[model samples]
Target: MTYPPDPYQPPDPYRPSDPYRPLDPYQAVQPPPPDPTPSYPPPYTPTSPAPSSGSGYPPPPPYGGGPAYGPPPGYPPPAKSPFGPPGYGASYGPQNTSAMAIASLVCSIAGVVTCISAPVGVVLGHLAKRQIRETGEGGEGLATAGLWVGYILTVIGVVTALFYAAIFIWAIAEGTNVTTTF
Candidate 1:
């Protein structure tokens, strides 16, 4: 068969390989962006005054000698405080050292003769020492000295009594007349 004298319409004249390469007529070209913003705060608000301090702290409390500055509507004032304890700081000093001293004095006679009373004197002397400690007193050495003295005296008295008793018995056993004056 014979070919047609001219082929179909020619190809596009504006292709990328053309002598003057053209941007697509349908698209737009734009420039790049600039730099950033400034540094700072926004703002502030207002306030009120104090009832007493003008800036607002509460007031100091009141004082007096009588009832209230005007008394309540009718209530009485508070009662006066009383002194505390049995003696209420009377003398404000240590107790007497005489407890042990008196016990020591009693021990002299009791220790020298009666064996039973001698132990009582020693117990009293110990109690006196405890009293001095509990009461911040002056009987420390006094009571100790008294107790030992009483104990020693008791020992001496007992030994002397036994000695005399032995001697008296020996006298009678030897057929001698034994007479004792109290």
Candidate 2:
């Protein structure tokens, strides 16, 4: 009677063992030896005609005929970063102009044209100067110009009024001095 196959034996014990495997199953297998001299393809040989002896680079195409190397037609240029460049300190947007300063300038101009708002312009100009000093806003030139214009116009208005009053008084006195024939 045939005995049962041993559990430790390989499934196909009759088949030939692998040539690369170690004789002892427990031993570490060694890799195949490498070739002493590497084999590589033969050096490249150019088939095209030889380049000109002068500069090797080909000449550029005639102006306007070559391909353009910028943004496509109708497309806008790339947007610049608001935060400046790498490693450079950050750049900020424009500072805001003071509203009071603008108002002062407008009122002063109106006063010059209408001769009624000079005092208002002067008051706004002083306020604008104070606000600009505290808040660090722009438009200082506008405030100063308004102040000068307002001051000059106000003084001129006062002097002209006084002169007209004096003339009216002199006319009344001259009329009283003349006796009426009636």
Candidate 3:
């Protein structure tokens, strides 16, 4: 059986007799009562002079007197801009397309219908690129696309022409009779 704590000797520091008791001696002491009267700072007062009954300065005008400073009466309002707001000025409107670039794209499309147009498309595309660099006109992408399509089609056309020419030359050399087949 556990024995009760010694009444005469001091309690052991490592193991307390009562676990709920506070460690600090001052924890159980009560605080002092507050004073009866509370203190506060003095009230504020402005130093500027008040307006007198007979002063020389006139009274301020009524609130709705147009604006303090702006355009005079009967003046026209600002004109609205078509491009954007009033500050943008004349740099608006649709940009001009490069004429040579449009021509290059058209010729490249025509090359699909006729093989002779491929070379013309290539020439026009090169001229368009030069003009676009100098004058800042639009359609640089159109010119580049036309050049690529024209080159690819031109290679195909040349190979097809060579193949047909070889077939005709071989038929002539083989001594085949041509009158009955037609």
For model 2, give the 10-residue run with minimal summed lDDT: 7-16
Residue-level lDDT tens digits of model 1 in 80-128: 6685456655675656675665776487556665666676777778888
lDDT of each: 0.63, 0.76, 0.73
Off by over 4 Å in 3: 1-92, 176-182
Q: Which ranges of candidate 1 are over 4 A from the true structure? A: 1-95, 98-101, 109-118, 176-182
lDDT (10s digit) by residue, model 3, range 1-182: 34454443344554434677646754453444553444332222345344354464434445785666654444444566777755744556777888888888889889989888987988999999999999888899999988988888888889999999999899897766555664
Q: What TM-score against the true fold does each predicted structure earn? A: 0.37, 0.51, 0.48
lDDT-better candidate, 2 vs 3: 2
| Candidate 3 local Cα displacement, residue 175, angstroms | 2.8
Judged by lDDT, which candidate is best? Answer: 2
Sorted by TM-score (best first), the order is 2, 3, 1
> What are the per-residue Cα lDDT tens digits for candidate 2 across 1-182?
33454443324543335746646766655554554553433232465444465454443434685357875544456779997776754347687899999888888878867888987999999999999999888899999998998898889888988999999999999999999887
lDDT of 2 at 67: 50
In candidate 2, residue 41 scores what lDDT?
A: 34
Clash-forming residue pairs, model 1: 50-56
The candidate, 1 or 3, that scores higher on TM-score is 3
Candidate 2 lDDT at 80 equals 96
Indicate which candidate wins on TM-score.
Answer: 2
lDDT score of model 2? 0.76
